[model samples]
Target chain A: MTWSLPLRKFLLYAFIIIFGFVMLYPIIWLLASSLKPESLIFSEPGLWPSEFTLENYVKGWNAVGDVTFGLFFKNSFVISIIAVLGNLLTCSMAAFAFSRLDFPLKKVFFSCMLLTIMLPTHVTLVPQYAIFHNLGWINTILPLTVPKLLATDAFFIFLMVQFFRGIPKELDESAIIDGCGPFQIYSRIILPLAEPALLTTAIFTFIWTWDDFFSQLLYLNTVENFTVPLGLRLFLDSQGESLWGAVFAMSVLSLLPIMILFFLFQRQIVEGIATTGVKG
Target chain B: MRHIRKNTITAYLFLLPWLIGFFGLVLGPMVSSLYLSFTEYDLLTAPEWVGLQNFIEMFQDSNFWQSVRVTLGFVLIGVPGQLFFALFIALLLNKGLKGIGLYRTVYYIPSLLGGSVAIALLWKNIFGFEGIVNDFLAILGIEGRSWVSHPDYALYTLIILAVWQFGASMVIFLAGLKQIPGELYDASAVDGAGKFSQFKSITIPMLTPVILFNLVIELIKALQVFTPAYIVSEGTGGPSGSTLFYTLLLYQKGFSYFEMGYASAMAWILVLVLATLTALIFFSSKYWVHYENGGS
Candidate 1:
């Protein structure tokens, strides 16, 4: 609002740029190291590679099995997509029920659902893994994606509930007046209107599932079935001749989708995460 | 009551997925865990009725207390570091300066990828011997050990990793900042209040509810931290067992050592501890958390 404000503003931008570099340096360093030769991963440390190579990418991607890098990439992509779709669909539907619909015993049921969200997943991992073991779903991708379809994550449901609450009551009344049933209203009206919220949920689901290492560790036993994180861990664990460059390479590669997602959905991701924080 | 019938069916259908998951995946195992906690159950042998033996045995186990100490050390040390860093960066980002988006994006990127095994691996290199940190330290003629492998500082690397993910909480705080009426600061400024005074009097109280929310989630998340502790400790909670956070300890007990019953008891104790702490937070909310809509 004044002349001094411009000077302060300039200083602020300068400060932020420095801070941004500080934050991003590790990632940049990883990417750069991934390009360097294995012998030089920790041996040399500067801004760029003395000898740049894509061999680490090749090695890291194919690290899973005799399988091509494309197969594991496809596996990661497929699981994440299905999981995200399942989360967005089932959670939104549940949120609609809890927030907008007039239902019997709603308050009691809704509170119980919230209680589940409050409990940490690690607390139940042992028993749940035992249950899954008995049910014979241990080694398959089914355990990972199926519960997502079942809306196991209560946070997404709660997020969708908050978003649903934000929509004016008039839209629902108007849809009802037009003779749209609950499912129709959900499919045609609410789903279409709640696109941003759905994207938020889907993106969050995709990232969480993609980055989840512990579950992948517990569920996928075979190296061929390993998710990106599991495969990367294996790379880390191999003996003295372990390829640090390849591990770093695969790590950077795995972050590609998330980086792209953040860049594209930049505004909504921040806004959605923040909104839920405020509401909670 | 008549209209409620139609909506009830619809609600049940909508909630069918969650209900099934809750009952089958969560609640069923939850009750079973409690039952198992009271028994000496290994996967091979059926659960022998052990009464309170698991609980009594735990009282004698020093490792159990060691875990409590390590986990509490993590929560106590890491939570404040994470929250304070988040809040500070959040305040800086809330300045409405140009290119704040750029700052927000870069800062939040680490959190997006923080939990991945790759980051854990990267953390080893970044914080370990011959890592960037030691390299920097060496330039100043100071020697640093393999921080990730050594017991004295193994947990600090995990703490750094946890703090790196403060981007999530920071972004939340930025949102909280926006909700505070900018006019509050304007009035404070007009009243000749300095920034610290304004922050103390206006920003903190206004932001209390969000802080409380962040604190509760952070507390729970910190209590359950597993990945870094596992990876950095080389899957052993190693270099004298310095980094064995509670969840990792439970995982090792259950899967590694085949002590399912003991791990179940540990898991149930974790649940009770967290539940009690969260309830304590809820009870204390009336004192500090000032909801904008009003109400004690």
Candidate 2:
């Protein structure tokens, strides 16, 4: 209280700005280094590149063995889009039922859904692999996209259930009195009203699926089927020191979709985490 | 009666996908995994029931024990370290500063990128021998080694990476901080409480529920951490196996070594351990965690 208020504010801002720079320096360094020529990446620790080149981006796009990074991007987009659609359709449907409808054993089913949110994926990994393997779903996108269609992502279901619970029951009652069916209420009223939650579900599903590595590594064997994460991993394994620029370039490219999504839907993503306690 | 029947049928129709998924993907796989744990199956041959052989061998496996130690060290150290930074930064940002939203976004970018292969790759190079970390240390005249490749420091780098991504938890903490009523702080000040004392008396107790939430979530996440270790160690868990996380070891066993049965056993152990730890935390919550509605 003795110090001038402006002085205190300046000091606080100074500390926060410096700390913020330090936190972001790694990513900034990455962007800068990716622009630099390969020879100078590690040698030049400075964030600014003396000279910039698009060579890394060009070379990295070609990636490994006749498989362009474009293919990986396409593969990633296909899987992510399918996953987003699957989660939105199935999770919202499940949430609508749980939040509005009456059914036998609803409590038991709801409890099971909640428990699955906390259940570790490891317990289901091997057997899930076996199931997919038996169905000849290996080396395909089915393994990634199929389970989503069944609402196996219980986190999104839980998230949507929370959102759906906030919708007034009177809306459903009026629809019912007007002779609208549950399906009509779901598609017409709830789905339209749940846009924010649906968008949150879509964004998170896309980002998670795009970033997912383990299942993709397991099922996606061929280079043609490799998603962005797998393609990036291939860069690590196949490339040498000279390709560090390319690696950094591809890495930045790999994160672009997520970065864009985060920027566009920043409020929803933050609120999604706050309300549901789900990780971004 | 007809309306009730129609509603029940409609609910089941809506739940049809989840039910099929539950029985087909989750419950079925879980039961199959449990059964597989007691057998010796390599995916090529039929599963031959061995009755605890995999579990018995796991106890004597030194690498398994090493992985347990590494994973436990990671969860124990990394979770608290992350939560501490999160809370601290949250408090700093909770001061109603200008451009707080920008600061929050900047801090949160790491958490968004944290789980990706690109970030893990970036972490590996950043800690490499000639990486930027050493370059910065050189400015201070402190010689540094390849932290990721070094046996003694490999796991620490991963822990540091985990801690670096505290932005998500920090955002959660910030939300919790905003929820604390201004009246409480004013009342405590009227009683002549100092800043630190007021924080102790008011802030800590009010934030316990959010703290517990972040703790459990981060604990489970830290236990399952794989991408960073896998990428950093190049899937070898090398440099004398200092970074052999449990999930990494399980991945190697099941896929790389074709020891599906043994891996199934390991998976069960993780499930049991995770369940017990979560239960312990929830049970301990009654003693410390304060709810406004007097405990859920």
Candidate 3:
């Protein structure tokens, strides 16, 4: 049945708004529940907290003995930052090679890189673990961050390759004519021009690294070495219903950095996924 | 000749980091993992040759079979459920709606946070017996059990969680929808085609490529899902093993049980199955997936 345009628009808006609210309700609920007292969180599931308190945040911050949420946050930031820098540098270099450089066996190497994009990480998990274990790097951030330095994240390389290909070859040709070497041309021309792709790589690397749980769970054994994911998992193992408020508080805290990044770079994140089809 | 040599050297220099990573992290480990699959290595001693033993035992393992069932159920159900919502919302938002960017941003937020431990933990509480879900059900005079804790319903909650983060796929689908020339719709309308007929004739055919891409990517991802099941079941694989994902069981075997060889076998099985499934999908796409430029 055909309806009037204004009536149709109103109904559409109403439906969209209701569905969007349902999509976002869990996150909003978590925020509200974190503010409520421990006893009231499950009982009072309304959006509004009956008794608002920062006690959960306070307690969750100091939940672990001598190893507070501050340390976990610091640890997460350090790993994510290092990973972002590593990916930006290494992946961009590889992308430049694939997109702009003329090299022997380039087709074969490029095809191999593309194949790795679809290869499940589980296939290499055991042997990689053994290699790291043999290196005495079991409890260190080296396992998590070192591979990133070597451009192991093929998706970022593919992304930057696509970005780099868009740049005109004439710019690099002229740079070569001006006596600039390949390295200089890459730094002076390509790196500056490919800022958007690099930033996308950096943002995604940070978020993915921050959110990575399995590798962190496998590598970091001690509480002192734990990142945010491991630290949050500690809450689950150590507490029952009594500390649900604190767990929720820490959960909210863990998502804060990512949420901030999402708000700041929502357009780039969305466009990145659209262009590359990278899945987390 | 000298210039060609110089270019080769320069290119090799640029690819050095990736080359190191390729060998050390990916290819080398892949070869070693394949070898480890047939050996009885447990980190304390050198690998002893035990050809086909791990694979043999895997077939008889009931837990392995359970995990396979759970994981297949998740991928079969979750991926389509997610893509359906993604495509539906994308179609709605592609109608030249005002404030479209705001809606896209609001919808995309969940996907950005979907993979995190925090969301998994939140999911556990939300599906708990005394959780917000039950509270909502009570308001409607419906009694709700602990969904995440129930064997029959545990995996469905995780599937719902997967479907909840359809924002990324939605964004991708929206981009695809925008690329469909509006003239097609206009032409179809001139032929007296209804909206549903227009969508079926033009929209579905044009969107098949994107649908295939999303299906394959989401399928591969859904197969490896671990965090939600791990967090929801507290790493135990559930009250009755209903949430026992393939990767979770593999993790238990390798790390917890120290059966690295067995885990490697499981990994190879996953890789083979994944490769075959991907090949099948691409092969099947010949008759279905459409491209504007036709076959390249």
User: Which candidate number has the best lDDT?
Assistant: 2
Candidate 3 achieves a global lDDT of 0.92
Residue range A1-280, candidate 3, lDDT tens digits: 8899999888888888889999999999889989998888866656899889999999999999888999999989999999999999999999999998889899999999999999999999998998999999999999999999999999999999999999999998999899998899899999999998998898889999999999999999998899999999987777544788998999999999998988888778888888888653
Give the least accurate 10-residue stretch of model 1 chain B, judged by summed lDDT: B96-105
Tell me the tens digit of each residue's lDDT in model 3 across B130-245.
88888889999999999998999999999999999999999999989888998998988999999899989999999999999999999888989999999999999987999999
Q: Give the per-residue lDDT of model 2 (tens digit) for B31-129.
A: 999999999988878899999999999999999999999999999999999999999999989988989999999899999999999999999999998
The list of candidate 3 runs beyond 4 A from truth reads A239-241
Per-model DockQ: 0.60, 0.84, 0.81
Which pairs of residues clash in candidate 2, taking residues 3 or more apart in a chain or in different chains? none
lDDT of 3 at B157: 93
Could you report the Cα RMSD, in angstroms, for every candidate shown?
Answer: 2.7, 1.2, 1.2
User: By the TM-score metric, which is better: model 1 or model 2?
Assistant: 2
Docking class of 2: high
Order the candidates by lDDT, highest first.
Answer: 2, 3, 1
**Candidate 1 lDDT, tens digit per residue, B88-206?**
98888888766778787788888888887778989988887778888779889998888888788888888878887888899999888888887888988999999889989999999
DockQ sort, best first? 2, 3, 1
lDDT of each: 0.83, 0.92, 0.92
Candidate 2 accuracy as TM-score? 0.98
